[model samples]
Target: MAEVPIVVHPAIEQGGRAVVVRNEVAGLAHCDREVVEFLRRVGLPLSDDILDDPVWVEWRGGRAHDYEAA
Candidate 1:
């Protein structure tokens, strides 16, 4: 199988090391409404907005492999 491309959010660094890394879906869905609207206007799936909340970070982390397999 071909390796899927993953889009990680620009890392959030603390003390010069990355402390947070979220998938593009989670990052974009959590971004400003205008950005979400633009993505929606472009016909991208919006069903994953549930990934936006910080509470879902661990869940999203676990799912990173799924993205990588996409």
Candidate 2:
């Protein structure tokens, strides 16, 4: 399987929705409105291909350190 390069940041809950920060492909950051537009542009299957990568497991578990701080 090809490794998908992505970074999944901790999800932020705003109002009643959960917003996740993600950096994908060419280091482009996506959150909030950008995420919606990304879904519209790339669609779910490609999005799922990126999201299902094992590299994100550490980030989801909070084991990955904050990238901004480093």
Each prediction's total of clashing residue pairs, residues at least 3 apart in sequence or on different chains, is 0, 0
For TM-score, the strongest prediction is: 2
Candidates in order: C-alpha RMSD to true structure:
10.3, 8.2
Q: Give the whole-model CA lDDT for all candidates, comma-separated.
A: 0.34, 0.37
Estimate, for each residue in 1-70, the C-alpha lDDT of model 2 and write its tens digit: 5443344455333211222334343222233344344445544444444444565322442333332322
* Model 2 bad stretches (over 4 Å): 1-4, 15-48, 55-58, 61-70
**Candidate 2 residue pairs that clash:** none
Instruction: Pick out the ten consecutive residues of candidate 2 with the lowest summed lDDT.
Output: 12-21
Cα lDDT of model 1 by residue, 1-70, tens digit:
4322223233232211111233234233333353345445545555455235433323223232133221
Model 2 earns a TM-score of 0.27
Error of 2 at 41 (Å): 6.5
Q: Candidate 1 — worst ten consecutive residues by lDDT sum? A: 11-20
Q: How well does model 1 score by local distance difference test?
A: 0.34
